[model samples]
Target chain A: MAWDLSSDRPIFIQIIERIQMDIVSGKYNAGEKLPSVRELAAEAAVNPNTMQKALSELERTGLVYTQRTSGRYITEDEAMIAGLREKLAREKVTEFLESMKRLNYQPDEIVPMITEREETQ
Target chain B: MTSLLECRNLTKRYENKTALSDINLDLTAGHIVGLLGPNGSGKTTLIKLINGLLYPTEGSVRVKGHEIGVESKRVVSYLPDHMFLNDNRKIKYILSYFSDFFEDFDSAKAYEMLGRLGIDSEAKLRTLSKGTKEKVHLILAMSRRAELYVLDEPIAGVDPAARDYILNTILTGYNEQATILISTHLITDIENILDEVIFLQHGQIRLHATVDEIRQREGKSVDTLFREVFRC
Candidate 1:
């Protein structure tokens, strides 16, 4: 759910990312019940309405589903999970590569060293 | 769900000047809303109206689906910008008085919070520093599990560190069933925590929206937009 980051970024985007991370990290399993809006808001130290906005967005992306009386739950679709993981991994790789470029280290310089460290381990 | 609080075309005017005008708003349960405005912008007057301390010159305010009166007062716990507690009373005694009046008052929660703030229950309000006095007032406001919590500038008198503590206390102590309305000019600090923000200027609501909507529509931080709109 959303958190009061007090940062320049809009909180709803961060909320979407947080729920995605929870799914990828296995903190919530497919078809499992998600926390109620009020409960998640309290845990995140945010307003309940803000938390609701985030959950509604997750539902739009097919990552979560809502039942009339039963509340929200994680989507059971395996493809949704795969998409989330792929998106996150791509973001991490882009950030890592950008950092390397700034440091003036090419792939040849960085990858060989990483492989060497891996072999030593 | 029905609105827990609503102000319909609310207007408040002094002999020659308007304090608030044509205001219409609604507040539901389980939201922490930011009530923001500059000095003399009627933030204090709005809080007073909501608390039934001041009467609206025109229109009406409903608390929990009824007009602001004795019944409405029972459901609302208000912390005014200025001190309301008797200066001569001990902090502990004042808290006890609050507990006696408000059915939802939690004395244990008040004590636990004061202990965290290093406040001595035995100390009289007159003996404490200004900052500590404000802290005590804040602790009282939040200790209640009221349906609606109306706090006016809860951190204005405290230092930055203490302000952070005050914000944290509000965040942690709130019950899921209650709605908190905080009125202050400190927009940047509270902007992140708000579900919706109502911006007042010249005693009128200029903007009201969810934080996400503001960022999406304006393409700027609330602080940045505030400066542009209200800048000298």
Candidate 2:
């Protein structure tokens, strides 16, 4: 998939978000080796330094870790991955709710609407 | 930690006008720096000074602690704003010339890039399309193992696919110990691939900061900030 980065936010932060989504969604398995910074940069069409910055931020959050001589890998902490999934899902749900509220949908109307769509599908 | 390029109060003046004024800048190794400005904003002058193609009216530019001289020229792989080479020759001929000229030129790499672009080695530069010529220049410049790569508007008027190719070539040509200085007004296309951006306005440095820093502090991309700063 194309790296869908918007211009108004920090590019590296977007990179971080993309990588995290990949990890939590099982696109990258736990303990899997991540691509080198250069490769990642090319894949994202971004500078390596920006990729480096994002990888470092991921490291700080304990989602990714470096192995020095070997390179970086996705964290083996499955709980951390699950936790991040929850956080991201909540953010998306909140966004959906806000947009629905803007459209004059009551808070009580969203779940049944979702279920009705689910049944129709 | 090594300073790849440094300028101290670097100024260039024409007969009655200043093109670049009192510019002090330092760039260390391992950066893709964007030199951005409007027309007549001295981006070209600053690049020329770095490559020793033009002399400064005052102040100095230093590359790896040496002044702009033969040593600096040897390490700075420059692609001028216009075609500097004679376009009457074949791709292979210029490839050989570059190999024989620059000590760091990688002929194999150049050939690979040309082949990837489906550009025939036997084709004359004059016979190629404008986009192909630009790609050839970018391939040749990037094929060098130089200390600095100074590309002046490499993607100014290219098509979208060509732009992607150029940026991908640049990204894959990563060198942790060398710096790439690219000058262009096309900010949105390149802002993602740049480490730092230097904004020049009215012949002076208006801002110099990392790309993410600009995004964090200003809450917008470099291109948006540039539009706000240099808007008519």
Query: For residues B125-209, what per-residue lDDT tens digits would candidate 1 score against the true structure?
Result: 9999998999999899888888899999988788877776677677666876788899887877777778788899999999988
Cand. 2 TM to true fold: 0.97
Find the candidate with the highest TM-score and give its number.
Answer: 2
Assign candidate 2 its CAPRI class. high
Query: Clashes in model 2: which pairs?
Result: none
True contacts kept of each: 0.45, 0.94
Task: Report residue B115 deviation for candidate 1 (angstroms).
Answer: 1.8
Backbone clash numbers for all candidates listed: 0, 0
Q: What tens digits encode model 2's per-residue C-alpha lDDT throughout B1-232?
A: 6688999999999998999999999999889999998898999999999988899999999999999899998899999888766799999999999999998999988988888778899999999888888888888899999989999999876788768877888888746788999999889888898999999998999999999899999999899999999999
